[model samples]
Target: MTHAIPVPLPSALVDHHAIDLERKYSDGWGMKVDDVATTPSGEMYTVSKIHRHTYGVDDDEADPARAHFGYSLISKIAPDGTPLATAVSGQSDLARQDTTFGGPTTGLGEDLWWARGLCVLPDGALAATGADDHTHLLTPDLTAVTAHHGMPHWREDDGPRDPFASWISTTPAGRLLCTTGEYGLYNYGDLLDNILAITDEPLTPVSKPTLRALACLEADPVKHTEADLRPGVLFAGEPVGMAHRPRPSLTEQLAKLDPTSRPGDWYNARLGRPAVVREDLFVVPVFGHIYRSGNRGGPFAFVLVTDQGEFTGQLGGMDRYLDSPFTGHALEIAADPARERIYHLNRYGLFAWTGSGDLKQRLDLEDKRFKPLRHFTLLDCTPDGDLVLTHRTQHLLLRIPCPDTLDHVGHAVENALRAYAKERTDLKKQWKPVTWHWVDNTAPVHRL
Candidate 1:
């Protein structure tokens, strides 16, 4: 019996063009342009990094000198790639004790909170998590309104650990729901390493493993009163990294522990996922998984949680076929109000899942230069359904149109492959060799 060879599909989606949104500054190293918002005037505003000057006194304490470094900034850019306005933060002249260099020096540097998240309220308020558990609320014009310093415990002793990520949504009761992730003191030391160390111990089954904090705050938009919005445990368990096990045929359990064991363990633990809000659904991507709930106030549960099966299903059952185990992580999600479509950028590709939980469309551009889906650390869908995506490397902002039809490309490819196979029996006769070629050259190439 001859096995039928499967053909790959062409991505139905095409890039319109890449828009250069930020000017007058370059993206800093490891700086992520997380979120974007539109002002009342229709100008696009983005949260990015900027270089600022910090002053430090000399060894003799004679005079203070200036040093320039990177800091977080909220910038407004025009459609034509012009910077309209910018508001800088997390920079001070005070000398910082540099433990790594073992000296006190004033220098512009990155703040831990900048990596966490930022969001714009419906009433044109800019809310961002700041250093020392400080939540800074600013007007639409970027003016500071109120600052809510987290509890003393959140900022005392070892100093406030920066928030991992934050999400903003309107509750059914007409309040703002702010969700944030806080790193634990013990777990704060190289998150990936600590998690791996715990996993290595066979006797020590992890009990009461606390995650980096995932807290929700309910704040009245008008009154500005804030209260704990989360119910029960925010994130109950610690995230586990991937570990490789030797094939049972190869090694026994005792032999697996040998120092020279074949097929070493593989682990890539990720926690503190980012959150996205679409109408009544609040979605969070954590530990190579996606979880969602309804609104903010009442009881909430997972709409579509991530698992090995779902991950494999999304990749069309190739997870097992590949040599490396498949891993899926959600970077951000975009919702189009006009089309009522939600776009999710996973580690795999850009997928458009329906509001009703149906996988509608997928555009697999994993090999592109500016893999918009892969590079998106922050994403937003405009009222018109256009996507505002921020790249991790370039820190470049992108505005792309979201397709109305979900999974249109996936369906088209499936149909095309079926039709091609049915119509061309000769091609199927040499199925093995021919199918490989077709999948490799799925997109039609016009030779001039």
Candidate 2:
């Protein structure tokens, strides 16, 4: 019996890869984002700014200063300095809440309503399975909306709705498909619902003009009112982030490379695992690039064997260019047969985004140069409130000298700082500070 050597596979999915989508909506017309509460974990219980109140102001605040509705279920705020009953927290009866929040105009038809496992279908419709154990659909042109609870599942008896198929996709024949690990699930019907969520039209069709419109009917004021919008027939509200997405695609070309006379290639391992150079198995067909460390966890020196069996590894990261900590895209090994150079186009960040769906938001995985960062458990403050940083992946943990600023972090924590600087250095000059980060973000997944 013999084993195969393992290799790399190009993939769309990556861990700790966070991107921010600056949400833009249709200029006017909005909804009531309301509700309130929080968990002991310090996360808020309401959906987004829904709990925001018009507090500490004499008149209506400017829109930017106003509590605009962002992604539903986006965060959990632990009020830093006051009691929950304060009017500013939306808990007091005297608090006035603002409901007006939106973006520029009609285009991407998907208005997120507690959606999860959002799969863009082949025909441009969106298949959104939500936390509510139900899936919803919206037309690409933003013309229709439908709710679906009947997508087929593996197990039938009322067990808690399997979160597995919460994600969806479609085949070339337009067949609705979803997946969990290795198995694909199919949706069975056109099961539709009366969309009461939001209306692109101002009023229900049977009634007259009651709501404001961008283009109001002049000839027949009563007949052509925006009020023509009805409960069941409506348009998606101003979408959040890159709310409109295209269907996800896999690297089907890899199938040809899969030398499995055993028939189908291992799609599961291909999508979920990282590239390796082990003797027992190679997922991809690239030549082996073997590397070694001087000591335990020291620098890795590699021998790059191309298709021609050419090799080079001593200079990979051994003696020079030692400042670059291997992380994210910066860790990838590449070849330049033309320049005769074997180097990585590696940049900083925990992970690199491979999706073309949201281009405007090119997330820099590393934290900003001079910004303050705080995370639970991993990077937190001590009892006296000193800033403590812990490296989860590298098993390194240390506290900085000053609790409030990144300015005081000196050579005492050089290893962590080196890794952090490698991640923080802006490789791309166009790196823009995120305006509003809602996509592939940090909030808990239950709010997904």
Candidate 3:
């Protein structure tokens, strides 16, 4: 079915405001922010936190001396942009303290569970995944309820090393449908094989599959060709070495694999954590593949599966329409109950897909500053229809009223940045490597 193109909105619906939260809470860093639930009094609440270590790096020494403990910042923001009541987490006993890998520093607990992926249950209890390897249920007031670690079937040799993100959706029967992204730290062959299997079918009754495997697909590997091994002089501030190797084709690899075996069966034997989920349909952005189920729970299996060939075909069409290849990584998926539209953020831009997984509309925010150089890591839709997106170092909370709204905001932001740049000409010169912090390419940042 064909879908109508979405018109961009005007700039008036979009407002820009910054809170000097860092100044107020000097101990904490704002790592991620997510909208939880609206109160009966019409107040909006969000959960934010400061992570113990910088994203991506597993080592504690990689972070500066000041980065140790995690902190939680919960805020109730008023309609007029005022913070109602702010809550902090580090001073409490519920915080978990553990030493992370890669350094001698001790890691203090912030709200790591809340940041992974959170969903408010029908009973108003919050369900989230924790770094402690468990799922937590918390009250609306940010108090803990009960925690469940599931059955703990994870084996280190299985596949993924970390659980980057997780989501808990209640099934129609009230049981939880938990999905997690696998930590991306292993070999590509094992990682891809596991993800394809997980996306194909649900975990067995005896196995508890965490969502960490899915996150591995976002892993970016530096491909070096043989010529790159030779050192060469830099030209025009760019390295003059061998060209990078192109990513391998999944279609070609799949053709060589045994087709008779189930995707999971092959993955489970070699890879640790497969990207398997119990959902009716699953899509992996890293693999650029889509899998569907003909029926909900009856001998549920994969129907339509894509490989690099299909990925190239879809990208070819997208490039023709957008005048560039769709490079955006699909991070989060949100459903528009009103329009039945599935909105997701990718490396290229924000796109809306139909229920059948067909691309409907694309919001290209490819100006100079907002170019598709980095993938969008955080995405959420507000109750009032605003699309909030966060990138690396930059945060944008936009109200997408129409197509024009995106262009308006882009121009306004560019103009504002230009003015700021002019005022701080010396600011660019003062920049040093020490002033910059390395964040994982896949980590998300949001305001509380």
Candidate 4:
């Protein structure tokens, strides 16, 4: 009996390709790209690590007097994948902890260790939020520091006091949106308490008036007023009833979770990176525990908010996706402005949803083509509608082509042959790789 050849199906096509940014650009020590952003013209900017902290990994004890001495760089990538310029926290000596451009009003240069958030502002500036409770505004070309919005730990600083801008995003017309909270896991309950507009002009100076209007907790005329309860664990000798309060132990807190409990039901509802859908619409993901133990009910996967800081509704939770498990719990999201759709990345796969929260399509991670690009943590969409993804652990970016730009027929055949090669190992040696050729010397055409 003769075996019949499998025909190609359009559904088998994958339009994504991975790029190793770390291998291409690293300053001796292996770098890891943490967060990424894109300009209106498709230029990419990334915050990458130059050194990692050794306190937690090497030893449990942390030195109070000595600085961690970690560093990161911001790079500018042109649309064609060319490295244009790179900016670091310190300019003169890479070993020095002192900053080239940093202050109390702006932020400490050395505070950018493992920078967590990055976004493009309206005036074409770049805003990066660091893991150390500070945000820096850099020039569009990643050259100089234009401004820095530092969320200081103390309540009575010479500078303005703003919420912990843990995560940030920008509106279509130029407003700065932030996920508000205090420092550490003890204050996790306050993580998603408020998703508010922090500033109108992030590139400008962070003034006392500007932060007063954007303050996270209620201000008190009397210092250390116990009445004004706030988030944070009470540290001994620290100012009492100030910005933090005594909380349950971590062990006790973890004990509250039952199998049916949800993230919101317990205590903390940490909001992931924010994605602006339009001038009035934005979405934030509820990033639960790594194991997702308390994700069986309550808080939805993604929360929809208006530009005015109104919570409209939630989408994709365990309860709603009982039939389709992969649709729940997203980590990062990006908006395709041209298509008016949002792309969400979760453990299971990447899902596309319309502005009104309808599912458009889903790309599973288990797919052969997506397997190589599965380790990404950050996601951002370019103006031209392509996705720029950064790996969670590695210094890399995976540029996934938009569906409209993909050659449907070519992709189908290429994947079909790959599947066939796996199925018929005996004939794999005779199979040749697929390549594209110019059909008429004008437009390139792909052929099997």
Candidate 5:
């Protein structure tokens, strides 16, 4: 096993930051980071927090959402794994704590819920969401900018539904998207502003395999705890909660929908979570089954969301679309605006695809035995083509190759990234680090 020195967390995090995650997993047992993000302009940040009542989520009353105790810590780090005292040069959690600005420091318990969003804005600023229905935008230099509340995340109708943000990403033009981990994938994002009309796009049929996966999901409650088996809703549970499986429940659900309606449609709108922008198309993962398509040893399909914010179709069957990290879960999918392509993390590995049905590469962990040990959920890519992954595990946070390089990923990947460089002249130009003076190119692949 590969062992590295454990970086200690702040006393505030270990002591006063009393939350459920520590009680269950033991404080400082490992890195324990929840998510990670890096900017093409040489800035990187990590979302580290132990969620409140993380495993105790059940009913609203029995386990009141307010009873949950969770707080978030956003820390900046250098590409070489050194923790920077600050990023963009401002105090890390000060904006949230300062009530002088009428900011609910706690943010409606944003960290109290399952997820908090992090993204670098188009103009080089950082934007993060709060549980209190607020969006925090920090200038690229780390100075907090207060006017970003103008960027409302949810639509008018979704106000009362409590749209929880699970994942977020930005467009080149600065448009923002926020998705919910709360079942039904309620989208109260800025993308809704361009609304033409509530989409009436025909629902794509849930394939036999997808149906079987759902059937199995209903059969095994633990596979996905978010399943709700009510008359119309099946598996729409909150972030902390899990649904019980009833064997005949799937059959009954099919009977309730319009005969012409597709199950995929219901899930697209209801089970929306984790979204990113790709040119004109908005993409989201279809949580129809625990293992949609990419859960196995190789290539799998991902569900796409229509511009209308409804799940429209699936993108699969392409070159380089191979390899999965075994959880069969495609946790996060991020798009590269420069190349106009998409990529995702499955357990311990990473896969990329060119928008034109050409998959780029599948770079996985060196030790296959450790594949099961990885938590590949948190993912985001910088405009310069570097992918950032930060998530929690027993030993906590670890970058692909110690925060600075991915050369440890082995020979095949190195060659693929090299060949990918030559795929398009613009791609070559974009990968050039000098364009962004701050970008680190000390690694071997960087010199390529």
Candidate 6:
């Protein structure tokens, strides 16, 4: 017997033909696709937050009166965008009561919900970071979770800290590094965007045996609570005041969607909460390098880091000179190893660059060609070079087909930048930094 080779998928994605992923996998709840990652073989993995109730869900509700608690899920898809497997992480109380989620027997442990970060580890295991400062390692098959890495302290400073990791990536040498979202406070209320080394040493390249080893490892048991038996209260049993009335039921909200309703309107009506697109990091494939954005405070620039996790320099620090960090660019980057292409995503459009850092093409996704999808957050590239994107306001995954070749915009932008640089040099020659001396003339000044 012989195995048949699978036909290759199209290199570019079709805008109107995007996969309706959230509808099929959201399990009848509001969900926001947070982060996405792809395997070398083209498998797509997505992490999403599961909203249990309709709009207006609040955390101020009582314990048993659960309004909204953090819940999340992971889905694995084939190269062709077919759903293969799904693993959900949520509180035991909600999972048991809601048929949409798995119970205590589910593969993910407790408090593992609110997962916002995902990356394919060097060993091919999936590393998912969630609440309580933990990163859970699962088998490549998504069958069993092997390890729960509890981040107890900041690795760089070795200080007591708690950071919510929302972005994770791998280096070419097989090391896993993660960073939390920006605005993270460290010791003494200091804001530091700390990069965490998940693996103490570089991992061996992924092999079938190493992937299978994850399933064989023994995982810790999850402790269950007594709230498993009771259904969570979405509304207060007795009305206390006029201000705290129960919101409309899911069915009532669904009824508002008529045949003429636009999909965006329907989505907006049931919108729960928005998930922040955090700072992202990825390895530049063919070049075998790492590029990342600052976690929090910006002027955001992509910093180049070595495979061993040492800062080399800023890869896109020139943006600070050309564009204002305040209103200019909130750029997210994605790389295509198959074609050795790099992409920069910003508010206006997308810019494609070569592995050698030359502008290749520019795409404005806001154009009418990519209709109904606006405000795209650049995710990851599929193995076939399709750009994966998602609208923060919409619950759909959009893809734009990107072939190996693109219409060359030449070095016009580069030449223009050179002219800009020359003008800056002339301006700099006319100015210099000077120190100001101040003398206090007030009374009661003692000089030693």
For all predicted structures, in order, the TM-scores are 0.49, 0.23, 0.44, 0.61, 0.50, 0.50
Sort the predicted structures by TM-score, highest score first.
4, 6, 5, 1, 3, 2
Candidate 2, residue 49: lDDT: 24
Q: lDDT order of candidates, best first?
A: 4, 6, 5, 1, 3, 2
Q: By lDDT, who's the top model here?
A: 4
Give the TM-score comparing model 3 with the true structure, all chains together.
Answer: 0.44
Candidate 3 local lDDT, residue 428: 30
Model 3: lDDT of residue 20: 23
lDDT of 5: 0.38
lDDT to native, each model? 0.35, 0.24, 0.33, 0.47, 0.38, 0.40
Residues 279-396 of candidate 3: C-alpha lDDT, one tens digit per residue: 3333333222323432111111111223211222111114422322223323355543233334555456555554355666665666457553243343444444334444333222
Task: Summarize candidate 5's per-residue lDDT along 313-351 as a digit string, tens digits.
Answer: 455543223444335444457666665666666655555
Model 4, TM vs. native: 0.61
Superposed Cα deviation of residue 424, candidate 1 (Å): 42
Name model 1 segments beyond 4 Å from true: 1-32, 39-41, 51-68, 79-81, 92-115, 130-133, 151-165, 170-175, 181-278, 288-330, 337-340, 366-378, 392-395, 407-448
What is the overall TM-score of model 6 with all chains considered together? 0.50
Local accuracy of candidate 4 as per-residue lDDT tens digits, 1-448 = 1111111111101111111223323322234566678788777777665443322332222331222234455667666544566555532223333332222223335456536678887778777785434666666766566555455444433444443455667666666666544433333321222323345554454431132112122221234345333322112323324443223322123334235554444244344666778767777655433344545424335656665445555454223343232333335678875666687665555666777776656555677765544555436777766666654443335565565522242243234334433543432333321221000111111110
Which ten-residue region of model 3 has the weakest summed lDDT?
1-10
Clash count per candidate: 5, 27, 26, 0, 19, 4
lDDT of 1 by residue, 283-364 (tens): 3332221225311121111122121101101112112122111233233555553454556654555566655445555556
* Model 2 lDDT tens row, 317-370: 232233232322123332212112222222321111111111111113244541
The prediction achieving the highest TM-score against the true structure is 4
